[model samples]
Target: MSGHLLMGALLTGILAGYGIAIPVGAVGAYLVGLAARERFAVAASAAFGVAVVDGAYALLAVLGGAGLAEPLRPIAVPLGYLSAGALVLLAGLTLLRAVRRYRGPLTVSASSPVRAFLGLLALTAINPATLVYFLALILGRGAEGGGALFVLGALLASASWQLLLVCGGGLLGRALTGARGRLVIAIVSAVLMLVLAVAALTGGSPVG
Candidate 1:
């Protein structure tokens, strides 16, 4: 790829990564919760898990896996609706849990790093929208193999941005350790996730 094209891809990747990562969805909320309950080491592993999934999707997109978009395209509308509904259900559950009387810090089961990694990888892989996003990227860019360097640059940019979000979550978790504080953050984030899920399902105007 030409220097200009590579730079453009890098910038696009950075923007897209931030765009996708910023939304506090199920995974994001879970990450924050994990961080609050565990140390940075655990949180970092979770973050790395997220990054690997994202990078894999980006690579697939750059490799002209636009064909993968077809199967999802036929069902996108229905799936979006279902995703929105699920989000709403999850939000309600979270709210109930937060308000209900409970004791002790939220405890995540102790699992090996590989388990955590696989958990996120599987979660992300099942997300049809992620693959669709990659397909869109491929179509917009014309082919994949032709822009290997640009693709790599974009993937790196995305990975870096996502890793930073994980780090930030770790920091935030440390800062909010009290019971009440954790409760408040969890509730607020759950609400945000609901909003995002609704937006995703409705095909709201693009933010980026």
Candidate 2:
């Protein structure tokens, strides 16, 4: 019975992880862009950071259960707004940097893996989606007998998917290096991110 429960919890966690990670929303857009500019190693660190946060949130959901909603709900809206604002700012900065690169000589600053990890961790943490999603699952009967195993599953699932995105972004970076189309890539990425930001800000799914 214990083994059965553990397996059930692991499966539930995997599903929940994929469910949340599969959505390439504003957060996803930023990660892809980060990977393109920062290389696979740094981006991989960032991806791991995101997965860790997911796992942490999953653990919270299972441990706190329904009680998790109380503290989370009040901050969810604020976090959602803050996240949207940050994305908007990021989109603007991306475009500005792209233009500067186009106009003249641009200096590239190297970012460390640790910095990337912490930056992505903080960025992902601000998104209320991970918390709310896991909380919903808990309330919806998803976390029964779930615990650390569940968090491990969620972390694995999220890590796998996010790393896949990093791979694609790395490939994109390699392809676009010194290519004229790189500018177009920057514009398109920024525009897509901006559009998503607007949608999130105006729509009810800001945190999502």
- Which candidate number would show the highest lDDT if scored against the true structure? 2
* Ten-residue region with minimum lDDT total, candidate 2: 199-208
RMSD of candidates 1 onward, in order:
4.2, 2.2
Q: What lDDT is obtained when candidate 2 is compared to the true structure? A: 0.77
Total backbone collisions, model 2: 0
Instruction: Provide TM-scores for the models.
Output: 0.68, 0.88
lDDT per residue for candidate 1 within 1-208, as digits (tens), equals: 5667667776677665555566646767766655654566665676677666666777777765657766776876766665566556656765666555236446553545676567555555556666677667768767533445544554565556546656776677678766677677668767776776767666841111
Query: lDDT of each prediction vs. the true structure?
Result: 0.62, 0.77
lDDT of residue 46 for candidate 1: 65
Model 2 stretches with alpha carbons more than 4 Å out: 103-109, 206-208
lDDT by residue for model 2 (1-208), tens: 4889989888988988999898887667767777776657888998998898999999888888887788877887677677778777778877776676767664563667898789778878897767878988888874366577788889899999999888888788788876355566667778877787777677545322
Worst 10 residues of 1 by lDDT: 199-208
